[model samples]
Target: MESSAAKYCCDNINNHGSSSQSQTSTCMQKFRLYETRSNFYMIGRDKSRTYWRVLKIDRLDPSELNIREDSTTYTESECSELLRRIHEGNISTGGLRFVTICYGIVGFIKFLGPYYMLLITKRRQIGSIRGHNVYAVSKTEMIPVPNATVNSSIADSKDENRYKKLLCTVDLTKDFFFSYSYHVMLSLQKNLCNNEPGQFLYETMFVWNEFLTRGIRGHLQNTLWTVALVYGFFKQATLSVSGRDFKLTLIARRSRHYAGTR
Candidate 1:
């Protein structure tokens, strides 16, 4: 069904009536809050190693939302148009629903609305942080969160210098680190107290940048709510009575002080 909100956008575009930005979103409430509320979409998966997704900010329409269930599948390029139209859309109706859905954001460098994001692609156990196994970044990928309208590769002759310079600054195979469920940043004492059954926070405020962490304060946070902090790729595993092709991802949550495996 065509939502009243989306319908209004088409109407407002045709009429060009002066409408307040807040009022426009209020009119879009039905479609925006439900279908387009998610921060990302699982576009597709291939074998066990490759996966794809599109940030919500890149989407053109809320009705296009496709969340892969155990039985669903997608292609890597399925959402490329969404990425392409990000720069093409007209905002005459009102402010566009764009947010860089990212977390664990580091670096002081800012590009307009979003900060550059780093994802750990490969990891190797280097040592222990307070008895917790800390893995070093063996591989990584740099992804610009917002629509930067520029290529990251040096292949573009016009942007070769600019892209090359930015690309040269990162070497993901070193220094970066991560541990799935371990609070490697905090000490064992504090972490132990954190997981004492009821004290663990659903959201960690400090991990978020000052701009976003403020509003989310004193509220329950979940991995789903902070999908931007997620690592490399999100895979969709689908299953059916006929057959199960989706690979199972096992996330083991251990108690404090008890180190878990990958």
Candidate 2:
């Protein structure tokens, strides 16, 4: 894809004919440092860092560059404001104009392609909710009831009240389970994609998933007795850090317990 700067330049070149020279020069000045060697040692006054040694920069294709150094500078406030505007649902090009200008200016001094520059430029604007507001539900009005005023008619309707309460609790529990389960699945999928399968983090995730799934299933069934059962299983699974074998065993146990209950 053409870099955002390149696209911007193409669009503005005709409208600002005389101004294209400075803009193009600025674009050319940004050079991305494409380093091939991944391993490098940095020695500092108090600390040193080691990176894995890999390919040589000389072996890399001339067109491939990794790091870009741009001279564009913006105050944190300005960046925050741009992000705020974005968060407030203004996603149009005009809404992003300030951010684009900020990056384009910076790109002149830095060595980055327009694409990468745009990516970095918009990093601050991705997840901010600066101009958003949240309103909470208001409390319901309370009706005064005398402590001694128990009508026989209402008392006779206790079974209906109990049934209604049970139905509401069950619905609430189901809603909670669905929401929590979706998040758990998302988290597990993210971890699996980002990390090695046999790693400690991965194994722990398996254990967590097993424990959580059992608990959620138990809750869905309204098996009140299984609450402590799942909790204890999760506590044990998390506390034991021997390795994958132990974690697998815990997961198996949780699965078996869930199956038996069903």
Query: Best-fitting candidate, measured by lDDT?
Result: 1
The worst-scoring run of ten residues by lDDT in candidate 2 lies at 39-48
Superposed by TM-score, candidate 2 places the C-alpha of residue 89 at a distance from the truth, in angstroms, of 9.2
**Candidate 2 per-residue C-alpha lDDT over 61-176 given as tens digits, one digit per residue, 9 for 90 to 100:** 22222221112222445434423433233233222222111110111111111111111111111111122211111111111111112223443266645643453352211111
> Candidate 2: what lDDT?
0.21
Candidate 1 deviation (Cα RMSD): 15.1
Q: What ranges in model 2 sit over 4 Å off?
A: 1-79, 85-90, 93-199, 205-262
List the pairs of residues colliding in candidate 1: 70-238, 70-239
Clashes of each: 2, 12
Q: In model 1, how large is the Cα lDDT of residue 213?
A: 28
